[model samples]
Target: MYSSHIKSVLEEKMWLFQLKYFPFYAEWMLMVLPFIWLITLPYWLPKFIVYLLEGKHLVIKMLILMTISLLTIFLIYMYVILGKPNQEKWKNVIFDQHIKRIAIKIYDATDNMIGGLVNRDVEVNRGIFYVERVPPLYWDVLKFREDKYLEFTNGSTGLVGLLSSPRAFNGIDVIGIPSAILHRRGGGSSLSQQLVKNFYGQDYFRNQTSLNKLNTLLRKYKELDEAKTFYHNLRENDGEEFKRWVAMYSPSLVSAGSVYGIESVAAMVFGKKPKDLSEFEQILLTNMYKYTHYFNGKAHENKCQKIKNGSKIDIKTYFAENPTKVEALIQDIDNWDCTDKPRVPLAFYKSMLAEDTKGQLLIGNPNSRIWDWAGTSMSILRHETEKYKIVYPNHLITEVKITIDTPKNISFKDSVNKAFQNVETKLASRLHVNLDDDAKSEKKQANIWISVVDEKGAIKYIYKRGNTHDKRRIGSISKIFEAIALGNRGDKYDYFYCNEAFQNLHNADGSMGGECQDNSQNNIYSARKVFGASKNLPMMSAFDKYVVKDNKGIHLIKNKIDDEKLQEIYESFNLSRDNNVTLKYELSFGLTNSTPYGLQKSVHKLTHLLYEKQLNYHEAHIMESLKYKIVKESKLINGGEKNSLFLKEIDSKTRKMFDKNTKIYMQTVLKSALDSKFNGTLKGFKSIDGYEPLFMKSGTTDKVVNEKKLTQSKWVAGAIKVKGKRYSLVIMVHSENGIGKKIGHHEIMKPIFKEIVEALNR
Candidate 1:
C-alpha cells in the first residue's frame, strides 16, 4: 500500500511540473517537429514520383503529393521564423544594464525621498509605482482569468481555418484551438503577446482591415519568435525567479485612459505598491486587461464591498494604529475566490472611478520635496535631451530615484514644524482670522514666506504659506544692494537734501508725501546716519549728487555709475538672469520688485563670500579632506555609488565683485541697521544658541487703498553664523490691509522669530 501511494504521488508531481513548463515544451515541439517530419519525405518522395509518372495509382499519388507539399511549406516557414531576431529594443532605451530605469533621481543627504528628513506634505499628481518582481497571486489570477490556455500557447496567431484566413500556429488549447481555427480568427493572446502589443505593436495594428489582419498575423508570428527568445533569456539571466516580471511590462494599450503599465494602474486604483496588492486586488487588475478605463467594478464589487468604508480612512491614521488589525481586515476582505461572480453594489467602484477622473486619487502628497525634486529632475532631462537632440517617447521614462546632496536633518525639520505651528496659532488668534476655514474671503487672509539656505546656496529649509514667487515691491531690502553698490564705488560719506515728500508719495490728496519722519526739514544728514536709519530722502540725495552723472544738467539715474554698478552686483549674485532689474532713486523706500527666492539667493551669495573670508588654506583643505572621508565611508557602509559631496563654489568673477575691504565695510554698515535707534527691524528678533548676527536689513513699501496710504509689503532679510556654519534668512509678509491692522509685528514676526529661536536653541 505504501509503494502504491508513493507511485501516485510521483505521477502527480511529474504532471504538475510538465503543466508548469508547458509553454517551453510546446515551443521546442514546434521548433523540432519539422526535422522529425523531414525524415519521412525522403522515404515517400520516390514512391510518389513513380506513381505520378505511371498515372496508374492516382489515389495514392495524390495523397503523397499533398503530404510532401504540406511538410515542405512547414519546413520553409520554421526556417524563416528562426532567422528573425528580437525587435523589442525599447527596454534597452528605458533601462540600464542593471535593469534600473535611466532617469535622474534626487535624494536628500540620506538618499531617500520619503524619509523623515522633510515634512510629509508631498502630494503627487499622478504617481508611478515600481516593483522588482510581481506577486505569484497576480500571475495565478491573470492566467486563470485572462486566458486559461496561457501555459500551452505561444504568443502567436491561431492556426485553425488556415485555408480560409492566414494565421500562425500558436495557441495549443484543446477546445478553443478548434473553435478559433473554424471561425478563421484568433481566440486570444498569451501574456507575452500582450506585452509585445503593449510595447510595440498597437501603433501599427490599430485598424482591422483584411490587409491589417494579414499584417497583424505576421506581427504575431514575430511576437511568437520574440517570446521564444525572451523565455530563453529570462531563464539564462535569473532562472524562474523573475517569471512574474513578464507581465509586469504589459501596459494597458487600448483601454486605460491616461494610465499605463501594471505599476501605474496599481498606484492609481489602490494607492498600493505592486507587492502590497491583495489577492482580490490582483484579480480586479487582471480583469482590467480588457475593460481598462471603462472597467466598472460590478464584477468584483461584492467581494470588495466589505472594506469600502475602511479604505476611506485617512492614510496617515490607517498605518499608525493597530496595524495588525488593519492587515487582518484587508485579508478578510480579500479572502473571496477570484472565480466567484460578484453581485454587490456598484457605488464603491463608481466612487473610485470618479476620484481617478478628477485626478484626486493620489499615492503621495503634492506639497512634498519629492514632487519638487521630480519637477526639477524632469526639467533637467528635457533640457539635456533637447540640447543634445536625443528624443524618445516621454512615457518610456516612468521610474525615478531621488538623492539630495545635503538632506536636512530630521530633527531640524521637526523643530521647524513645531515653530511654524506655534506661529500659525498665535497669528490666527491675533488676526481674528479662521486660517483653517477654506471659505474665508481673500481680503481677510494674510500670507507669509520664510526661506533659509546654506552659505553654498543649497536650500536647507523653506516655509511657503504665500505666493513667494509673485513679484513684490521689495521696499527697503533693496537697501542692502544699494549699500554694496556704494561701497564698491568707494563712497564713504556725504548726503543732504532730504525730500520733504518722502512718506506720503502715494497719498490720493495729491499733496507731496513724506518718506522719513526725520526728513521734515529737508535737513542735510551724514551718509552713515541716513543709511543706518533708512532715511529715504537723504539716501536719494546721496545717489543723485555722488552716483548719478549730470547729462545736459538733468542728472539721470539711468546708464549712470549707480545703475551700472547695481546691475553688475545683481549679475554677480544671479539676482536677475533675464535683466528685469529696475532700480529707482526711491529704492530704499520700496521701488523695485523681487521674489522671495531671488532675495534668498542674493543673501546666500553674500554669505558664501563672508564664509570664505574666514577660511585659511589649511582649514579649507582639512574641510575638503573631511568631506571626502565622510562620503567614502558612507559608500563603503551603504554599499552603492553615492552622490558626490562636491558643493559648487562661487566663480572667480562673482568673488571679484567685492574686494575684502569693501565687504568688511558693507558688513559694518548693515550691522548698524539693526540697532535700536535707527532701522531697528531686528530689534524684535531674539538671539538663538551661539548664532551671532552678521548683518540685517528691513523694508516697507506702501500702496493706495480707499484713498489712504497702506503698507503693502513688509520684509526683513539677514544672515547668521554658528558652529562654523552660515545661513541666510528672509521673511516676507503681505496683506491687503496694512501690517499695522489686525496683524502687527508684535502678533506675527516677533512671536514667530521668538519661537524659531527657542526651537533652534534646543
Candidate 2:
C-alpha cells in the first residue's frame, strides 16, 4: 500500500508540473541539458575510482549522487522538448478560424474625412502583396565582408540583418552551450521566425523590469502556443500583411496624424524606395531597427563610429553610393545634420497616396520635433477595431477619434487691466491721495497694489501701481512676519521687555524709539502679546536670540527654526536669505525693502495658509487641478463660481505657489491676532459692514517727510469671508497728502478694502 501511494504521488506531481509550465520546462532544459554530461560521463567514475584508491570514499559518493541528480534533470528535459511538435508535424495541426478582417480609418487632427459611411479594408491600401518569405537558411547577409566592401545576396532583404546574428556563431563551439545560451540571450532568431512571434506573441511574460531571455521566454512561449492554434489559419503570403505592418510600425511621416507605412518614412528619409537601397545604405536602414535616434538623428563622430561598429559597414561607402568615390564623399555626409530630413515636404508624400484625398496640413518645418501624440494613439484604435471587426461588416470603421487637451484661456489680460484702473481711481478719489508736487518730482514713487482672489477661482492682481516690478519700502505690513520669527525661539522665552535687548537699538541720544506704553519691569509677555501691539523692541530681541544667536553664543530661546523649514518658508515668500535682512546684530527691519519685486505676493501666500482648517486638502487640490483642466479644455472660467485658485496664464512656473503647507503653525498664532479687539492696525475691519466676517492682521508705519517728520503709510492685509466665498485683501496706501495727525489702518487702507469688496460683491 505504501509503494502504490508513493508511485501515485510522483505521477501526479510530474503531470501537474508539465501542464502548468510546459514551455519553460522545455526551453530551460534546452539551455542546461548539455551540461548534464559533466555529471554522467564515465570519466567521472574513473576519477571516483582514483580518489578511492587514494582513500577518498567521500568523493566517490558525491560523484555517484551528482550523476543520479543530473540523470533526473536530463529525463525531465527530454520529456518536455521531445514531446514538443516538430516543424514537419506542424502542417497537420488545424485551426478552424476564418481570416480576420481589419478596418482602416484616416484622421486629420480632430476631423475625420474617411471611414464611417465609407469603410476601408487594410489590404486595399497596401500595394504589391507579399509574394513569399525566402527560407531562413537561404538568406545570406554579409556585412563589411572585407574593408570598404559590403555585400548581401540578391534576394536578401533588410529583415535578415535586422533580426539575425551572424550565421558562423555556434553557442556550443564558442563556449559551452549553457554559458553561451544564458549570456548571449539564445544567440539569434531568423527574421521570419521573429516576425511570426512579434505578430502572434501573447506577451504573457513581458515585464517592465525584466531583462534579456527571461523577458523573451514567456512571450515566445505564448507566441509558439498561439501559433499551434492559428499558424494554419492566418496567412501572410501576400504583401497586404507586410504593407500594413510596415506602414504601422516602420513608417512615420507626421506624428500629428495616423501617418503610417515605410513608404512615407522612406520618401522622407532617403527620397527613395526601401527595395532600391544600396548595400551600405541598406546596412544603415536595417540598423535603424535597434535605435532610430542614435543613427538617424545624431551626427557626431561618436554617433558615426557607433553605426559603423553596429552594422560592421563603412560610413564612407554609405555616403559615396559609388564605391570608387568613397573617400571623396565622406566629408559631404559628415557635415550633414541627422535631423535634416529630406527636402521633400510631407504634402508631397500624401500626393503619392492613391486615395484622392490630400494629406493633413503640415505646420512648422518638418525638421523640428514632429507631433507624435496621434501616431501613438493609432494602435489603440486598431486594437479596438479588431475586437469588433465582425460586427462592423467589411471591417468598417465608422469613427476615428483624436482629442488634444492643451492649456487654453490664454490670459485674463483685458478684464484685469480694466478692473485695476477702477480700483486705482476709487482709491485716489475717495482717499484723496495728493499727486500735486510729488507727481512732477524726479521719479517720485507710489505703489497702489490691489490683489484679490475670489472663492470662485478668479485672481485679480495689480502690483506696484506705477511700476509693478519695481522696489518700494512697504510700510508696517512687515510686522506680521514676527509670527515666523517667534515660532523659531530657542526656549518659550518670555518677552523680557526690560530694555536690556534694546540698548544696541538706541537712537542718537541713547533713547529707544517709541517705547511700549507698558514699561513694567520683569513683566514677560508671550510672543502673541507682542505681535498684537507690533512691538519692534522685543521683535528685534527675538531676531537676535532666535535668528542671529548673539555674540555670547547663548541660546536665549529654544525651538529655533532649522535650516530646512526656514528654507521652505523663505522660498514660499521669495525672500532673499543670502543677504542679511538686518544691518548687524544691532540692525533693524522696518516696513519693508524692495528685495523682491512685490510684497503683495508674499502676503497672498500667508493669507492662503489662513484657509487651512476651512479648506479640504484633497478637495481643494483636486478641484484646483480639475478646474485648471476644465478651463484649459473649455477656454473659459465661469465667473461668480466659488472654489478657485485663480485665473492666470497656464504656466508651470506658478503652480507650486498654491501650497497648503505654506505656514501651518503661524496660522494658529495669526487666528488669535485677527480675533483681537479692533484697535491699533486692525481698527479698519470695523468699517467693513456686511454679511461676511473678517480675519486679519495689520501694520502701520510712517514715511519720513522732509527728513524731520513722518507721514502715515497705512496698511492692512487679510481675508473676508462672505457667503461661501473668501476674498483675500491686501491694501498698501501712502497718502499723497501728509497726515496732519496720526492715522491707523481704519482710515485709508481699511476703507479702500471695504469699497473694493462691495465692488466685487456687486
Candidate 3:
C-alpha cells in the first residue's frame, strides 16, 4: 500500500509539470516554425513513413504530429503575413512612398511659395502629408517606401492614402486592400480634419460649389476689363467685398494648377487628353497675373491721386479760413503756433494768482502774502488814478482816503459804505452794475472808506480815515475795475497782463517782465526788491525761487490794476518771451526780493525817479529829433542811395541816445552826493555807495531841478520792418542795471542822454 501511494504521488507531480511547461514549449516551437519551414522540406516528407511511425508509437507520434502541424500552421501564417503573391503590396508600398515623396515635394514647394510671399527663405524637413476624413485624426510616423500606401482603421472602418490599382471584390470595386488588416496590425491615423480645415476650407471636399459661383460671376461679367474695373471699384468702395473676391479668385487659381496635374494623370490613363493647356487653366494663369497687375496699378493710381489732389488745395489759404480746423487736424505737429495768442480762461488767471492777494480778489487767495496784498493795493491805486483821469477827466485824483475795520464794521458804516453809496447812486448807474437796487443799497453799508484826489496833488475829498480801509477798498475795487477794463479792451489784456507778464519781466532788465504775475516775485514785489534780493543768490536759484514765490505777489498786484493803457503795453511784450528766458528771469527776481524791505524800498525809489522822468519827458519832441538823427546816421553808414536809410539812421540815433543818457545819469547821481560821503550834501542819503533818496517835507515839494548837457557822441542805429509793416519803437535803458561793478556815473547816464539827443534831432 505504501509503494502504490508513492507511485501515485510521482504520477501527480508529472501531470503538474506537463501542465506547467507544455504550453511554453509549444509557443517556442511556433515562434521558430517559419525559419524551420524555410530551411527544411517538411512538406515533402513521405506520408506512409509518417503514418507507420505514428502507429508504432502513438503518443510520441501524436506529439511529433502536433509539432509538425503547428510548424505547418506557422509556415502558412508567414506566407499570409509576409508573402506578396499579388501586386497589392507593391502597389501599396509604391503609393505610400509616392504620397510621402509628393507630400514632401509639396511642402517644399509651398514653403518656398509662402517664403516668397512674405519675403523669407526657409528649409523643409521630411514628413508625410495626409488628409483625414474625420476631425482630430493623427498621422503616424513610419518609414515609407516607393510603392506602399499608409493605411489605418478606426474600429471596423478603413482608410488609405492614395489608391492602389483598382480591383473587383464582391461586386464592389475595391481600389486598394482594406486598411483593416494594417490597422489590426497596429497602423495609426496620421492626418486629421483640423489640418485640412486650416489649410483648405471646412467644405473643401464639397468641390465645384465655390468654383461654380466664381465662374458664374466671371461669366456674367464677360469682359476682363469690366471685371478688373469692377474689382478695382470694389476694392476702393468696399474692403469686405474686395477680401471676398480675393478669397474666391485666389483659391480657384491655386486649385486650377492642382486640377491640371490631375488632368495630366487622367490623360495618360484615358488616352484622350487635350494636347494644350486647357481654357480653364489658361484663364486661371492669366487672371492671376491680371488681377495682381490690376491691384498694383489701382493702388498706385489711388496714391497718386491722393497726393495730387492734396497738393492742389493751397494749405496756406485753408489755414487762413479754417484755422481751428487746421489746428485740430495738425494738433500733433511740433512747435505749432495754433493761434496768434493762447486763449487763456479767466479761471486760469485766477488759479495762477490764487495763492496771492490778486488771486484772492479775482478768485480768492487761499494763501495770501502780506506783501501781496500791499503791492496789489498800491498797483490798484496807480491804476485807478490813471483810469479816473481818463474817464472822469476833471475828477482825476492823485490821493485817495480809505478806512479799514472789522468785517462787522465793514458790513455796517465804513469807506466801503460811502464808496458803495457813490457806486450805486452815480457810478453804478453809469457803469451798469448787474445788481438790484436793494442789493446795491445793502452793499453800500459795508465797512470800507472812499477818498478822492486831484491831478494837482490835492485831496479832492476824503470819505475814510484809516490807511487799512483805503488799501482794502483800493485792492478790491482795483481788481474789479481791472476785470471790467480788461474785458472792455478785448483779449489784449488777457494776453498782456496775464500771459505776457513773465516775458515782459524777462526783457525788462533781465527780468521776465511780462510773465503771468504769479510766475515771479518781480511781478509781486517792486523791481527794486527783485534786484536787491536776487543780488546774493545764484542766477538759476534766484530765477526759480522768484517764479515760485514772487510770481504770486505780482499776480496779486496785477489783478488789482485797472489801467487799460498799462494792460495794453503788458500784453504786447509780456506773453511773447521764450519760456526759458522767462524762467531764468523769474528766478533772478525771486532772489532779489528775498532781502530786507528797506533795501527794496530804496531801489524802488530810484526806479521811481527813472519812471517819473519817462512820464514827464517831452516824448514827441524827443521822438522827432531821434528820427532825424537816425536818418542822418543811416546815410553816413549805408550811403545816400540806400532805400531803407531810415532803418540804419534810427539804429545809430538809438545807440547815441543810450550812451549820452548813461553819462548824464551818472553825473546827476554823483553831483547829488547821495552816497554816504558828504552826509549833509545829500542829507537824506541812506548810504555812501548804496543810499536811499531823501524825501521833501511835503509831497509837492521839489528839492532841486538841476539840468546839464552832456557832450555829443556818435551812435550806430539799425531797424527792420516788423511783420512786413509796423515799426517797433526801440529804446535802451542805461543805468547800474548791467553786469560788473556799477559803470561810471557818466557811463550810466549815456543811454538816457542819447535818448534826449535823438528826440531833439527828430
Which candidate should be chosen as best, given lDDT against the real structure? 1
Error of 2 at 484 (Å): 2.9
Better model by TM-score, 1 or 3? 1
Residue by residue across 481-574, what tens digits does model 2's lDDT show?
A: 5455444332232233222345555421244543332323242435444444454555554543432223443233423343444344445555
Every model's TM-score = 0.52, 0.33, 0.14
Residue ranges of candidate 2 with Cα displaced over 4 Å: 1-445, 455-457, 460-464, 488-500, 503-523, 543-567, 577-588, 591-598, 613-665, 668-679, 691-695, 700-705, 734-743
Is candidate 2 or 3 superior in lDDT?
2
* C-alpha lDDT of candidate 1 relative to the true structure: 0.47
- Regions of candidate 1 where Cα sits further than 4 Å from its true position: 1-112, 115-188, 193-447, 491-529, 532-534, 544-562, 576-586, 614-651, 687-690, 722-724, 735-747
lDDT of 2 at 638: 29
Global lDDT of each candidate:
0.47, 0.38, 0.25
Best by TM-score: 1
* TM-score, cand. 3: 0.14
Evaluated against the true structure, the overall lDDT of model 3 is 0.25
